[model samples]
Every structure is written in structure tokens, then in C-alpha cells.
Target: MKRLTIAPDERRHIERLVDDVLAEHGHWDPVQFVTQAKTVAESLPLRVRQFFRQIQSEESDVAVLSGLPLSPDLDATPTGWDMAQKTGAGRREEVVLALCSAALGEPFAWGNQQDGRIVHDVCPTPGMERSETSGSSTAPLSLHTEDAFHQCRCDYVALFCLRNPERVGTTVVRADRLDLPAPLSGILAEKRFRHRPDQSHVGPHGHSADVADLDAIMFGPPGSCYLRIDFDDTFAADEDDHAARDAIKELYRHMCDAVERVVLEPGDAIFLDNYRVVHGRDPFEPRYDGKDRWLKRVNLIRDIRRVFLSTGVRSRVIS
Candidate 1:
């Protein structure tokens, strides 16, 4: 468990940087905002920058940064996911999120998600409380690797929390924490796992969507096996792969027993190595009365060029 705290001076530096960027850009443009974030990343504390440079994905699955400055009256959490106002950053916390993510790599959005919005709002909605999207608070979200069905899925998922009054728990299951049985490990390392795209990533008007054709749940080098699983989105490609099915059951039991709950406080952000961790949240009542928990989430890619669908200096959703 690695942690980094923004020093008082560093926090002040951030405030000045954000203010300057907003005054220059005059709007929250993803392209320009990300570039500014990268500059802010360079001015961050040395320890934070060093850790991001050298952290082994499998060894340090998640890193938390704390002691950032928050806007006045934290009670003013956004009510919904709409940014129809089109005004620049509502607060500096989002800039912190993007800056921290830029410290690692390029941040990108999903074309089929949130209408290609790079920064996504994570707040419980009235009708979506039981749904499978991030807005759900009543239904426990099953552990999952972000966008497991996509070939160009994010390498890291960064979440910045601005509000969380209920102290609800966020479930995290890391591959580094799992010591699977040989049989289960062997089965999971094969390429027989089935994955369906998360409902949030599917578009209504588009080419035909199909299940991803994948062979393994934990694929990569032998030592650093990359995890790819979403119990809700994953199924057996061959129902008769009893060995694989049995392995899945056993693995689930092990992971459930070893799950960890992370509760983020004000101005706290966590960056998860998506290839090494599966995360979810426990079921909680969302009052939805403007005080519900809210987090700004973004997906990071180590190498955007490898996954980009078009040529452009600006970032975009993978096609």
C-alpha cells in the first residue's frame, strides 16, 4: 500500500497552476486541459512523480494521494452528470484528477460511454440506483476490471472523490493479493474466458455489438499476469469447460474472502492498475438529495498511440 500526500506548498502550487490554466483556456476543453494537467504533473512533489514512474503494476496495485485542497463548502456536490452549462471546470479537484493521471500516461474516453465525455461523473441517480452503471448505489457492484471486453481498455482507472458523507465502502480485489490453486491458475491462464461489454459501453445506434473473444482471464507474462474478469460480464465460451467453470467458482470464493474496502475522504484520489485489480462497491442507500457521494473518474492508458483509432494530437475515445 503506497500513499502520497500533497505538501502545503505543493497544494498552493496546484491552486496557482489551476487558476492560471483556467484563466488562459477560458473553458474546460479536454485537449487543452490535459496538456495543462501534464505541466502540473511536472510540478508535483518528487516522491509522487517517482512512484508513478517506477511502480510495478502487479506489486503496487493501487496508490492513494491525500491532503489536497478542496473548494469551499463541500456540500455543493453536483446533482447530476449533466454539464450542459459548458462552463469551465466547476472546481479544481477535477484538474487534480487529470493532472495526477497525466503523471502516469495519456487519459482517454470511451466512445460508447457518456457520449464520449472524458471525465465521467460518479453519483447515484434516482432511477439508476439498482442498475449496473457507476450511478448505482443500492445494488452492490460486482468486482470487475474496467472495460474488460475492449482490446484497448484502460491500463489504469483514476477516481477523485469530492463527496462521500455516508462512508460507503469501495471493494477492491487485486491479483497481487490472490494466491490461487494451481488448477485454477492454469485454467484462468487459458484463452477460454467469455466477456460481454459492460452495459455502459454499449451504444444504441452503431455497428453490431458482440461478445469479446478472449482466451484467458489472466494473460501476460508468467510472473505478472494481467487480470481480466467481470463476473457479471464474463461467461464460459464453452459451457462444457467444466474445469474452467469450477476454477471460476473457486477463484471467486478466494477473492471474496480477501476483498478490501476503500473509503475515500475529501480531496483523496486513488489510481488503480486496472490490469492487476478488480474493483466494485458495496450496496448503500443513496439519499440522492444533492448530498450523495460524487467522484470524478477517468481512464488512463500508458500508450495511447497503440490503441488510438485515428491520428490526432488530441486524445479521443478508442474506435
Candidate 2:
């Protein structure tokens, strides 16, 4: 009933469109995927189309579309990135996510993450069961803007669910929703914060980008503040780092009071405006018996020129 939901007819139509695309391509190809998905999204039912466009100006940090068809015989949750791309085709849920991503901008992947594969599997990995990365299941992931430490991080991030046996929820916190206290707000506005890149970019298969300090947490057009931060990776350079630790503590306090958790079903996909909000996942038991929760993730930048300008490389990855 809410804007975050999808109607039965809309879902069916989306599936039909996805079928049309797969009939020719038969696989998930990023370049062709966006062109076709855009057309399908534009032709979606008025309600759904309206919701899709809301990513451009919506006050809510996250927009979700549900009820698209999901196959019961979906492949076993992928253990890693290679398996994810190898098995990502023909899923209307992926098409739905691609469509939403195209509406905002071009979908891109980080070379440092998931082996630079276009599609990423967010499943509980065997050894990473307790880490903070997407593969972890036992620990509650802290809030973060995906790739917040990067200068060319995406403008939007979307997660499409293929399985969720545990129904574990993702937590969201909106920067616009909070009325920050004067001191904390002032500190956050200062160019005193330092955020390290997430683990996805720190490992051996990680990016070559330098880990540097962030100038400010909130900055954008007037009346529209975009936030970039990570609870696990960002830290103060020193105790005199503009009360950085205290500033983080204050944000955590606010988040504790105003967090919203959404449990995505099999047919649901949520597109988050990365610049407007931060997201994390709740702790869940990993049933590595091939039925654990799983999701597909992709990042989108509103402008392609930003990517080129940031790294001087015209490729999708900044690292």
C-alpha cells in the first residue's frame, strides 16, 4: 500500500519486460542491461514509475519495489562473486533491480570488490562468518555509506534479494530525518573527519586507491545534505582530530534512537540513495547448508563524468 510496495499487475508487466530482454540477450550484460531496463522502467505502471523516479528527489533514504516474480528453483546461493555472475541471468528480480538502477544513472562495480564482477553476491561466506563485510552473518554490520572513503563512491546502491531464509533485516538511517544538535552538527560539517575504506577495498584483491581522510560528513546543495561515513572503518587521526570520536559517538546515539529496519522478502528489492542515508544489516545465524540469506548488490553513480574525473580512468572502477 505504501510507495515502497508493488502491485500485482505491475509485477507481471515487469516480468514480461524482463522476458523480452532475456529472449535476446539470455544473460545479464551491464551495457545492454541498462538500455533495456530503462525502457521497461519507463513503461512501468504509473504508480511504480512515480516511485522509481522518487530516487531523484524523494525524502526517504530507501525505496523498495516488491512482488516481482522469483523462481522457486533459483540456484543455490553463490559462495562468491564469480558464481554470482555465472548464475545471474534470467532472474526477473535482477532485471527489476537493473531497471531501478538505470533510472537513477549508470550501474557500476568496484574493481577492488567482488573481483570487479558486474554483479555481486551478498551471502554468508564460510570463513568470513564473523567479519563486517557483506559475507558475514554472525555479526551485526555497522552503518556505513558503501565505499564512503572513496572520492567517487556511488550516488545510489541497490540490493535485490533472491533468498532470505532467516528474514534478517537491513537497518537504515536518514541524514535528513535527524535534527542534529548544534555542536555535533557543527563538527560534522567541519572538514575534520577521516574515514578509511571498507574491508572490501583493503584486502589483497582490493583497490590501489590511497586511504585518506574525508573533509566533511555532510555537504551538498543548500537544504540537501549528503552524508558519507562508516562506523567500522572511519576513525579520528588523533584525539585532537576535531573531537572525531565524540562526533561519531553522537551520531551513533542518534542512530540508536531513530533506526528503521526492513526485512526484504524474496521478491523485494531496495534502492538506497547513498548520499542521503546510511545502511547496515542485523546479525543472523548462517545456515551454510546452502539455504542461507542471499542478495545481489550493485552501485550506481548519477553522473559518469564524476567517475572519470575522480580517477582519470574512464572505466567503471575508481580503484
* Residue 142 C-alpha lDDT in model 1: 90
Collision count of model 2: 0
lDDT of 1 by residue, 185-285 (tens): 88888888878888676667322254747668887777776799987888778889788888778878988998999999878888888998899988888
Residue-level lDDT tens digits of model 2 in 44-163: 677776776665765556777777567657777777556666666335556666766676667777777877755567888878878879998889888999888877788878888888
The segments of candidate 2 whose C-alpha lies over 4 angstroms from its true place after superposition are: 35-40, 86-92
Model 1 RMSD vs true structure: 2.4
Candidate number achieving the greatest TM-score relative to the actual structure: 1
* Clash count for each candidate, listed in order shown: 3, 0
- What's the TM-score of each model vs. the native? 0.92, 0.90
Error of 1 at 82 (Å): 2.3
